[model samples]
Target: MSSSLLCLVFLFFTIVAEATYSPGGFHHLSSLRQNKKASKSKPKLPFETRYFPQNLDHFSFTPESYKVFYQKYLINNRFWRKGGPIFVYTGNEGDIDWFATNTGFMSDIAPKFRALLVFIEHRFYGESMPFGKKLHKSPETLGYLSSQQALADYAILIRSLKQNLSSEASPVVVFGGSYGGMLAAWFRLKYPHITIGALASSAPILHFDNIVPLTSFYDAISQDFKDASVNCFNVIKRSWEELDAISTKKNGLPELSKKFRTCKGLHSQYSTRDWLMGAFVYTAMVNYATAANFMAPLPGYPVEEMCKIVDKFPRGSSNLDCAFAAASLYYNYSGSEKCFKIEQQTDDHGLDGWQWQACTEMVMPMSCSNQSMFPPYDNDYEAFKENCMSRYGVKPRPHWITTEFGGMKIETVLKRFGSNIIFSNGMQDPWSRGGVLKNISSSIVALVTKKGAHHADLRAATKDDPEWLKEQRRQEIAIIEKWISDYYRDLKED
Candidate 1:
């Protein structure tokens, strides 16, 4: 359609979006599409109104001395009526652009929401530059960049947006994936009144101890690997034995990683399901971790296997090193409460992903090597440092601390404040909400899909799959509209 006609359609819908929320006061957002359209239009105003570009309004800030930044995107909502007066926070400390500006991936949520979409560059990266250059230079300064601090920033922006976006307080929705899931759950808990609802998907909210629900997750991954890979388990078994002897050395990762690149155990053929965790585990392995009574870093997969993956997808150069870089970043750094391992020391076990849990933990190392060839190359570590890192950094204050997960503390806060919660997850999504619904608060509803990968379950890497990913996102938007209706209209129990 013509640009002029598109604008008119958007304006007309903006007014209708509000009424859609309260039709008959029934709490049934999922079924609201069946309801009739409201007979109304945005009122004619005396003053000239200015609208931001349909695209996102991006901004950044520097608050510390490490390697992170605070960033948010002002996403225009697709409200048929001018009802949304607030912003929606995507899960965790992340680049809000993915939720707002990355129109392609954020499929459903970004386009239609008229309310601003705020993406907070995690406290240490992107344009939300906190602390100056060399912020990640040491662990002491990196302490300021934690989940506690990032959550505080989420609240700060909500208030700021309310004042600037409009005088009226906009009902905000905290949305996100995996680590973002943690952010969404906790944000609603702490600032229940400020946020209307949260769409927390595939979040690891329950503590590591609560991981029992997903105990089969690793087995599921290993089984898939073994099914497709020839003697993959034997290779890993050998690697573990070797690690038994060398795993104690703090500086041994370099030597082990070299061998891992060529190890046959690592060479196993992974299926679509294996792709989820094998990819994610490799990322944590790159850093260091001690998990499941193992004493070795993840055995490196086969070089040919890694190479085949890189070849299947297009690349800027042949040097395309690791096949699992994006998966690694998504699981480890996930932008929620980012933790750095500035200086790693090994005990009985070498480095592991579990280090983030220890109160005495230091920041993760941020050398260009860890994130250089990261996918969506626009966010490589080099760019991360250039775009966000600030000068003077502050250590985290106690107030910045976040709540833990014995219960649906975060989701509960959302409903207490009168918000309808919707969590979106892919049934096969590995690192995210693949198994989160059973443990979440009953008040919150999850939107589940079967054929998704990570990040709302679309396959973005394969050659013939981008189109499929796009169509999946389109479907997600319609789901969001339905959810809004269910919350605002059908489930009036609130």
Candidate 2:
């Protein structure tokens, strides 16, 4: 996938790309899709939207540092007792409410633990923009936005919330999936005094500094389709070569647009190709067993569905037609947009914000090779850094995340302070390759599943959910219960 398009999918689970990122009545995709016939009877939770300060320089204290901006958050105490446990979601690249609406797993387990569910927005994302629309105007303002500072924000906000609610004794368990999941784990590593444990679901915690190969992401995406049907992978691989040939011919751009049924005439073949690549990447990420509308209106088993489309390559039909037909399954699922537009501006999913993150500390090396289903593409680190410098005047820090947090030093952290943390990963998820898939210590566990997608275990439980997820949740609940029990026991011992 192109770097820009790749940034778009990073927020596929957290940011709303097609729709507005507003706090309104939005139901879980699994529940809404399942209850299409009984939509009127579905009960809704009354989540309140609130904000907090956006400290410009979290490390330094100056008069200009005290700037306040809206950091949106949602709190649900419906199942909480006076001194019950608290469940906090470290929001990712999009709106906080988006994460809150989709993370029904936290709600499903909240009542059992009598926990208060809190979803805090990440800085510079969603409505938590520190500089408002002028965020990217002055590059200096963006300096305040970093993973370390965001973790500090959570620590500060949680402490303030505890004092305000008089629930200081409540054992806090941090929960997050994907990028948010990385934050959850790092938060525990940095602030163990505040959070008792963390549930890092489908987090690519080791995707940096050669811990996992840079090509692992696209390779896993290729495997998703290959596992479904090798024919699908071959056809997709051939489609790229066919597109390259077509673009070289006269009147190729218009002919390509006509074949794809695009609403607008094609301007650049590169953009169109990148958009299609992103579609495939997004489909693999949200290939749940049941229907979900997280990033797009995706049906259950999207990769398999995509394969079904690719397999029906009619005799004599052009290769471009076969590829376009498959791509439409995702881009035109809603049938609302007249043409496919790869907008470079900010999307509902905060694509622009995510792009800035990619340019800076969150530089996950994305490249394509012969090993992947797609053709070879250059992933030059120097070129990537130069592009970042040209765009944001910031150089890419490829080793920053691993340097601050434990990348290869994971075992050391586990030996020293890791306990009651669950790193759940799905076999089908490309991000799983970068995550922990083995038990590092007595209390640190990794739950792996064969039939799961990216963070599928983090969504609301459905009847169609695989048995592995059911078993995973059971173990997670038991572990959390023990953590809470042990915390209070240690408190008494002290």
lDDT of each: 0.35, 0.73
Give the number of colliding residue pairs in candidate 2. Answer: 1
Local lDDT at 327 for model 2: 76
Candidate 1: residue 389 Cα off by (Å): 25
Question: Which tens-of-lDDT digit does each residue in 129-172 have in candidate 2?
Answer: 87885655456887777788889899989999999999889889
RMSD of each: 18.3, 5.4
Q: lDDT of candidate 1 vs native?
A: 0.35
Worst 10 residues of 2 by lDDT: 14-23
The runs of at least 3 residues in candidate 2 whose Cα sits more than 4 Å from the true structure, single-residue gaps closed, are 1-8, 11-45, 334-339, 342-346
How do the residues 206-261 of candidate 1 rate in per-residue lDDT, one tens digit apiece? 42322333223333333333433323322332333344344345655444344333
Residue 157 in model 1: shift from native, Å?
A: 1.0
Best by TM-score: 2
